[model samples]
Target: MMTIGMIVMLIASVVMVLASFLSKKTTTDREKSSPFECGFDPMNSSRLPFSIRFFMIAIIFLIFDVEIALILPMVMTMKSSNLMIWTSTSLFFIFILLAGLYHEWNQGALNWSA
Candidate 1:
């Protein structure tokens, strides 16, 4: 036995379903698929070159953000008997990070408008 609220919900759901069914229609061609923004045509082509800054920031974000994944397993498992393993892993991670940073610095990748 459904409560009154449940019955109302069912009716609303059925109405929504019918509305969606009426709204949906498959179409093809330019009239069906043109840019619709403020009733104005788009000025730029899709092939336009985007700013290098966008890609640079994205690569930097990917490099620094990945260390979280490297550290997470060790943090969760807490698997440490010999300090050397943890110490070496940590130093290795830092070494690689610094090396990459140094390379970027030398190559002027870190510089603005380079």
Candidate 2:
């Protein structure tokens, strides 16, 4: 007997193959083929300059979000059981977090008035 994981994988693969075959006759035209821009033509040659600060903030957010996801489960486990585990995990997570915050502070990424 196939395991549940294997049965699910097989069903997923069959569905994907059927979807691909059904979509083969889709039309192509100048409007359909060209890059879509919300029905707007590409008129401008040079794009506007974007500040790296916004991108930096987005990257930093993603980093912290992932870090939180990884640590929250462990943190919760500590909270439910023992104070020693709680203190150790909290200190470990906070230490690296503070280090990252210090780096960002020094590099001026945290500055919004720039």
Candidate 3:
């Protein structure tokens, strides 16, 4: 029974891999592969320098946003959790987050202008 099951699995895997390869064409088209820019030819390089301040602010916002999302579930689970432990855990997490924020602020990554 195990041999039969293994044989069936092997056959299925071979068939799926063959199907994928058979579906792909060897033909290559430069226009199709090149990135589109509103149907216009690209005059400049695609890579551009991004603002570090903007990137840092975006990362900070995302970190806080995710923290809020995680905290929401803790609120729902609070009734089931030990009060003292929960409060201490929550305070520690927030303190860590604030510490990170303070570190970033001290590094001047939060500043927009040079």
Model 1: residues with Cα > 4 Å off, grouped in runs: 1-31, 35-40, 75-79
Residue 48, candidate 2: Cα error in Å is 5.2
TM per prediction: 0.57, 0.60, 0.66
Write model 3 residue lDDT over 1-112, tens digit each, in one string: 9999999999999999999999997998887777789955576787879988889999999999999999899899899999999999999989999999999998999854
Candidate 3: lDDT of 20? 100
- Between candidates 1 and 3, name the one with more favorable TM-score: 3
In order of listing, the candidates' clash counts read 0, 0, 0
Which candidate achieves the best lDDT against the true structure? 3
Worst 10 residues of 3 by lDDT: 39-48
Best by TM-score: 3
**lDDT by candidate, in order shown:** 0.76, 0.81, 0.90
Residues 28-73 of candidate 2 have per-residue lDDT tens digits of 6765666666645655544668878887888889999998898778
Question: By summed lDDT, which 10 consecutive residues of candidate 2 come out lowest?
Answer: 39-48
The residue-level lDDT of candidate 2 at 56 comes to 82
Error of 2 at 110 (Å): 1.8
Return the clash pairs for model 3, or none. none
TM-score of 3: 0.66
**Model 2, C-alpha of 100: deviation from truth (Å):** 0.7
